[model samples]
Target chain A: MTELDRVIHEPARLRIVALLAGVEEADFLWLLRESALTKGNLSSHVARLEEAGYVAVEKSFRGKIPLTLLRLTDAGRSAFGGYKRAMKAVLGKG
Target chain B: MATDAQLRDLEQRPQRYWNADGIPELVMGLVWIIWGVALLVGEALPPGRGQQGYWMVMPAILVLSGFGANWLIKRLKERLTYPRAGFVTYREPGRSARLLSAGVAILTAATLAFLIVTGRQGGTEQSAAPAIGLILSLAFLVAALRQRAPHYLALAGVALMLGLAFGALRLGWDAINWMLVLLGAAAALLGAWRLARFRRCNPPSVEHHP
Candidate 1:
């Protein structure tokens, strides 16, 4: 497996990247709801992905509420595509 | 943890959402051409008073309205601030609904044409176009309601057309002219309101890339 695949193989990080990849950007609350992850768990995983350059985070205030928007980076997209292909190949479905 | 070097690399990548100003321009240009053609044809072709000439103006007015709408949409796009979302997926309307709407639009245009051609002589002959338009409109309203689609604009269009047709037949040509003017004003007002709402909802973004 490629090094990128290794990074994305973690269950929490994988789910975080997958959700962000499908949208242009998503609110932190939306990601939590969709992934069914606890606030702390989701935040930790998001931080890891953000550190890995798989996601970009924008923190701002929507009215009085603090909003965190997450977007997948180009590297994240390429890595995700590669991981999927590698998985398919391993499963003999590619 | 990812390194600072990685974050810089990620930031260099391009964005996905591109401005779509050209699409509105193309649509507006096409509407203008159609309106120009209709106006020229209406003027060149001589028909009886309140006949073909009058009916031809309908297409011209519709095309101009379309042009104005496109222009307004283009202006609104410039001010949209929200982070772009992917296309929203909605349930498709049933086959019956689609067919009914298409049928009504076609029938309404056809009936209007027929009345303009046959009733040009200013005779006392009863025109069926108005009745047909009303029935077609009702059918469309039912279909739109069944599918839970936005039918206000369709409802308004149908109502205006039917009102004009009825006024023309019952009251006379002068009443029909007044009704058309009222419809035009209403449509313009609605279009302006929608444009304003669109602009307010969407704000400009400096970070977006093509």
Candidate 2:
């Protein structure tokens, strides 16, 4: 598994990555509410991962309302795949 | 599964987002100018202090404070963690339309109010500075709250308005001007610190959707 894969192993970040991995982009509020994580918690994790080039954050407005959207990186994708494979291998299912 | 792959793909790309910092400042500055003009007119039509020449200082203070706030914020952009959030493509405002409308509304109301009230004008040709500043600052506050944007600019506006209004109403005109100066200085200093912090961390480039 790659270094990017290892970072996503954290449960909360993994969940974040998992959520973003599924949708084109997830609104920050939605993610925070859905993930049940505080702003600071999510931000710190996202910041670390983003700095590591595993995720991207976007900021814009919807009408007058500000929105934040988060997405993963290509490296993140590769790592996530490896993580899945490693998990499967450990489970003796692959 | 196909769904799993889709989710993974979604995570890997950048998305577009918006930053409201510029718009708020722009609105705040415009409103400040309007308030200054109103104060000048109000001072002109006053019942007292009409050629006292002391009232002239109010508009000067307003102009200086408003411009100073804007300048400080712009210069200190590097220190603050200004909020930048993403909106869906359908959510973006029509190019500059809402802003224009808001500006027109504010100007019209302020102008009408100044003309109608000051015309009868029995009070101590009191510096309209406090009232005008309050209204203008409130405009920024309303915009910031409505937009669900960052609070720094709005907070600064509120603080200035409150300081000036309360100071003028209670302590007297001289106190209000000095209060504004102090408030401006504080905002400038805080903005500088935030800008310094912002500079240390390069913000992520937001993507444009649609």
Candidate 3:
């Protein structure tokens, strides 16, 4: 039996990673809108994903306002792909 | 754990984002308007043998519209969509999509060349309208189906109708120009409506926390 990626196993994080996988990069508000996670909760999960080297976070300013952009790293993409395969296999649908 | 439906929705987020702003449609509308103007001008002042160089402006309009619209759309996105949705850079589609796009481009070129050659030989104004209409319909249909965008389907229907009116009914040249102008107006309105709705749905986030 193949084990799931623990980092992406959590429901909220799984959703976040899945959303990020579809785009090259997304900003914090886009993630918030899509994931429906609270500001603090979303931030923490993004930080954890960043720490695991699965995501890259960049801080920049659009005008005077700060913008936080998040992207799935190569590792993140690979992990997400693996996670999907594992899920499908476990569901007996692979 | 996310449900299967939830994951599928997540996978489609980028496609939604790409269409959300409606900038592409607006740009396309402007391009059509320009082409209509070019066609009308060519009709009003028929290019003579020595002055056939005037017809070259048609291709120039196309090339410039492509580059200019891209730049304008980027700037518009920066102002309109970036603040509210927080910007997202989308990835290109897979290899199969690219190959399909190339195939379509080749087919369109061949079809357009055939129409132009046939029209010149026949000395008919009607030939160009159907060709343009067919191309527009195919482009809209492809985009609509691929993106699951119902609005584009409406555009495709309109394009087909206009094509039939021009080709089958043998409508005059001015009628084709007028129809294209009307389509451009409709596209602009659609884009504006979608842009307003997108803004209302996704208000800009207030927090600037890093």
Root-mean-square deviation per candidate: 12.7, 14.2, 2.7
- The sequence of per-residue lDDT tens digits that candidate 1 reaches over residues A1-94 is 3233767778667777766655667666556645667878888888888888889888876555456777889998888777766766665576
Local accuracy of candidate 1 as per-residue lDDT tens digits, B43-123: 455678756656757766875687686666545443341332222112245799999978977987797677656766665
Top-lDDT structure, candidate number = 3
Instruction: Give the range of the ten consecutive residues with the poorest summed lDDT in model 3 chain B.
Output: B46-55
Ranking by DockQ: 3, 2, 1
Candidate 3 lDDT by residue in tens digits, B67-185:
89889888898888878777788897799999998898898789767766777678776766776777788988988877878899888878877877777767646667866776787
Model 3 has an lDDT value of 0.82
lDDT of 2 by residue, B1-210 (tens): 223444443343322112322432433434444454545455456576664565677658666766676665444332232222222222234669899977997987788477547634745324444654565467547655545445456454756566566645654343334444444444445444543444455353343222
TM-score of chain B of 3: 0.80
Reference-based TM-score of each model? 0.38, 0.34, 0.87
Which residue pairs collide, candidate 1? A51-B2, B79-B202, B79-B203, B80-B202, B80-B203, B81-B202, B81-B203
Highest DockQ: give the candidate number: 3
The whole-model lDDT of each prediction reads 0.54, 0.54, 0.82
lDDT of 1 at B15: 20
Candidate no. 1 TM-score: 0.38
